[model samples]
Target: MTAHEERPNEPILLRRDEGGIATLTLNRPQQFNSLSMAMLEALIGAIDDIARDESVRAVVIAGEGKAFCAGHDLKEMRSSHALAFHQQLFRLCGRFMMKLTEIPQPVIARVHSIATAAGCQLVSMCDLAVASENARFAVSGINVGLFCATPSVGLSRNVGRKEAFEMLVTGDFIDAREAQRRGLVNRVVPPDELDAEVERLCASILAKSPLAIRMGKQMFYKQLEMGLDAAYQLASETMACNMMCEDAGEGIDAFVAKRKPEFRGR
Candidate 1:
C-alpha cells in the first residue's frame, strides 16, 4: 500500500484483513464501543479510504469484547463541556452511518452482542447484517428522554413502520431471532459461528461482478424513494446502462463459452 494509504491504527478501532475483506473492530469495549468523536472520525476516514481503494471489495463492522455498541458516549454527553458540542457531535455520528450506506462496497454488521440506540442505527445502515443468536437490539434513546430521531431514519426503512415505532417508543430490547423476524437483520447464527458466518456471506457477495454490485447497490437505495412507476423506469435505465458495461459483456460471453469470467471491475 502507498504511504498515504496506510491502514488505520487507533485505539478506538482495530483493522484486520483477509483476502479482500476488511474487518473493522470497534475497540472501546470499556464503553461498549460507544461513539466518541475520535472514533467516529476514524470510522469516516476508514470508509472514505475504502471507497477510493480498489483492493477492498467488502467490509465487516464488528465490535471487540462484549457489546457491539451502546450508541453515543453518554459520559461525554453529560459533561458541562459537551453542551455546546452536542450538535456537531451528533452530526458526525450521522455522517458516519450515512457513509456506510453511500459507499460502493457492501458493509456487513457482525452483531455478536447488544446493539442499542445509535448502535441499532449502525446495524440498520449496513448493506447486510448477520447477528449472533445471543445478540440483542433496542432503540433505548426514548427511555433517556431522547427520541432516537436520527436512528429512526434508517430503522424505519429497514423494518416495518409499526415494528420500528415499537422499538423506538418502548425502548425495549429484542432477541436476535426477533430482529430477524422483524426484518432488521438478515441472518442469526450461534455466537461461535458469527465470524465464520459473516465470512461465508461476504465470500458469496465478493464472487459477483464488482461493477454490477456497486451499481446495483447505488440504484437500490435510489429507487426506494421514487414512485413505483418512476422507480421501474429508473431501474430499466440502470439495467440498460449496466448491460453496456465491459463486465456485463464478459459475463455473457463467458456464459456462452461455459467458462468462468475474469472480471477486472472495469
Candidate 2:
C-alpha cells in the first residue's frame, strides 16, 4: 500500500498443510503484514477453497514477520479516495470476516506482536485465539482519526461492550494477558511457545468427530442471533440430527465398549 508495492513475484499469503491443519500466514512482512487488496483477495480465495476441502479439518491464521496484521492498507486508501472503492473494499473485508465463521472447520489465530484495527478483528473473528504473552491488541484506527466501526462488530461480540468501547474509543492497547482476561484471546503463553500451544488446540479438535464439530459450529453461530425459545428449538433439532449421524452412534458404542471412538467423519 505504501510506496513499496506488492511485488508480482512475492506471495501475499502462504499456505502450509499438515495432518489436515491449514496454516495461512500473511506474507507481507515489510508492511507488518497489512491486509492490502491483494492480500485480502488471496485470503478470501483461500477461505473459499478451505470451505470446500473436507481434508482440512482445522485452520490457523498467522502472520509471517515481526507483527501480525496492522489492519487495512492505509496507503492504498489514501491513493484511491473514491467512495465506490471504499465501499467495495469494506464489503470485501467484512465478507471475509463473516466467511471465517461460515467455514465448517474451526479457525484458530496464532497472534503475536501487535494486532490492531482490522488485525484485531482478525483475532476476534477467529473461533479461538492463542496469543503470545508479549502480543498486543487494539482497534486503533481512532488514533488515526478513523473509527474502527467494522472491527468493533467482532470486538464487541468477543468482549464486553464497556471493554470493547474503551479500546475502540481510546485506541488503547491490551497485552495478551489482558486480552485473555477480557475474552479477546483464549490463551496467553511465552512467545516461543505460541506454535506449540496452537498445535495442541488443533490436536484437541482433531480428535473429535468431524461431523459433530461441523454441525455444532453451525448450530453455535445460528443460536447466537436467536431468541431464547428459538435458540433452544434450533439447538434441540441440531442435537437430534447429530445424534442420528453414524459418528455419534459409533461414539456412544465406543464409550460402552471402553475404547477411544473411531470417527469416520460421517
Candidate 3:
C-alpha cells in the first residue's frame, strides 16, 4: 500500500509547491516535530517524489510549532528495547539523511528555532541552511548518556572537528549566529525574516541553469571526498559537460549581447 494509505489520521509531514520550490514541513508540533518512524517514512516518500519532479528547482525543509525539531521521538525509542529494532530505526533515519544529498534539487533547512540531537543532524545534512536569529542548535544525546554517533557524521562534515566534538560531548547549545560562524548554517536572520531569507536563497538558485545546478551539486559532493588531483579531474569533466549544454551556449550568447538568458533547464 502507498505510504499515505497507511496513515488513518493527521499527516506527520506536509508538502506544498510554489514557483518551482517545494516546501516540506514536518508536522508534529505538539511533539516538537520529532522523527518518528512514520515521519521518516513520510519524508522518504516525499523526497523520492521530488527527485523525479523536474518542475521542482529547489526544496525547503521546515518545522511547525515552537521548536524546529527536537530529534528522535524519545518516548517511542524507549518503547522498544530490542537491539534489532533500534538498528533498523537508525538505518532508516540514515537512509533518509543520505537521500537529501543524492537528490538533484538543492535542499535548504529553514531553521526557525531549536534543532537538537538528530534534528541538528538534519540541518547539517541539508545542502544549505537559513536559520532565524532565535534558533539554537545542539547534539544533545550526550546529555542523557547517549552519544550522538550518527549525528556526528554530518555535524563533523559541516563544522570543525573540535566544534562538533565539543557539542557532541557537552550537549551545549549554540546560538544561530555562532552556528553560522562555525559553518553549520549559511545565514541567520530575524525570526520574522526567516521565510524571506529562505525565499531569497531559493530565488537565487532558481535563477540559475537547472542543468548546471544538478551537475554541479553532484560533482561538488563527490569531489569533497576525493584527492586534490582527482577532485580537479572530476570538476574539469563536469564543467566541460556543462559547457556542452544548450543553456550554456544561450548564456554565453546572452552575455555577449548584454541581455537576459532564457534557460529551459537544458
Candidate 4:
C-alpha cells in the first residue's frame, strides 16, 4: 500500500529536534513517502521555519516507510493533466531543491530504502547523504516516458555527466555502495546502523563553530559557480571576514592554550 492509501490523513512532514539536530521525516510511509504537492508545501514551510531558527545547527531529511521517497505523486500528476500545472509543479519543486543548498545549516539526507525519480533528486541536492546498505537510488522517470529533467540538475551536479545521463536514459537503479562510489552519498552503512551513522555525522557538524559554518556554507555553494580566480577572490574575502568573528579568535587562542574553544555562536 502506498502512503496515501495506507494513512491518508497523517501529517506529510514531521519535525523533531534534539541536541541541535533537526530531523524532518517524510511521514507518508504507506505511500512510500512520495512528494505530493502537499508534501512539497509541507517541506517548504518546515525548511523556511528551520532557516529562521538559530537553534537548528543541522538537518536530517529522512523518509518513513519502505522507501525514502518515490518522487512525485503520479496519481496526483495524472489528475492535473494541464501543461501549466505541470510547469508550476516542477518550478515549485526546483525552488525547494535550490533552497536546500541555500540554507545556512547543513542538510543531510538519511536514505533508508529505494529513492526513485525526484526521490533520488532529493538525495543529490543534500549537502551530504548517508544511505543504508538496503538503499537503492535512481531517476527513473524515463521508464514511464517522461524524462527526469529537473532531477538531472541535481544528479549531474552530484555525479558525473555520463553516469547521470546513463541513469536518466536507462532508468537503472544503483545500490547504496554504488551511490557512494559515484559521489552521490558520503557513506553507506548497515540498515540497522543507519541512525547511529546519522548521529555520528550530526555530532561532527555540531562541534564546529556555527558562524563559521554558516559563512562557509554560503561561500561553498556560491564559489562553485565562479571561475578559479573569481572563486579565490571570494574565498579570500570570506576568510578575512570569518577571521574577524569572535569564534575565530577564540578557536585560535584555545589551540595555543590546549583547551576546547567555547563558541557562543556570535
Q: Which numbered prediction scores highest in lDDT against the true structure?
A: 3
| Local accuracy by lDDT, each model | 0.89, 0.93, 0.94, 0.92
Model 1, residue 17: C-alpha shift (Å): 2.5
Give the alpha carbon lDDT tens digit for every residue of 125-168 in model 3.
99999999999999999999999999999999999999999999
* Candidate 4 local lDDT, 33-114, one digit each (tens): 8888778877888888899999999999999888999999998899887999998899889989998998999999999999
How far residue 193's Cα lies from its native spot in candidate 3, in Å, is: 0.7
Question: Across residues 149-236, which tens digit of lDDT does each residue of candidate 2 receive?
Answer: 9999999999999999999999999999999999999999999898999999999999999999999999999999999999999999
**TM-score: model 2 vs. ground truth:** 0.97
> Between candidates 3 and 4, which one is better according to TM-score?
3
Give the least accurate 10-residue stretch of model 3, judged by summed lDDT: 1-10
Question: What tens digits encode model 1's per-residue C-alpha lDDT throughout 1-266?
Answer: 11111224436777887799888888888789888777788899888888987788999999988999999888878874655598898899899998998899999999999999989999999999999999999999999899999899989999999999999999999999999999889999998898889999998988888999999988998899999998999899999999999999999999999998888797
Q: TM-score each candidate.
A: 0.93, 0.97, 0.97, 0.96
- Indicate the TM-score of model 4: 0.96
The all-Cα superposition gives candidate 3 an RMSD in Å to the true structure of 1.7
Cα distance off (Å), candidate 3, residue 252? 1.3
Sort order, TM-score high to low = 2, 3, 4, 1
RMSD of each: 3.4, 2.4, 1.7, 2.5
Q: Kindly indicate the candidate among 1 and 3 with the higher lDDT.
A: 3
Error of 1 at 206 (Å): 1.1
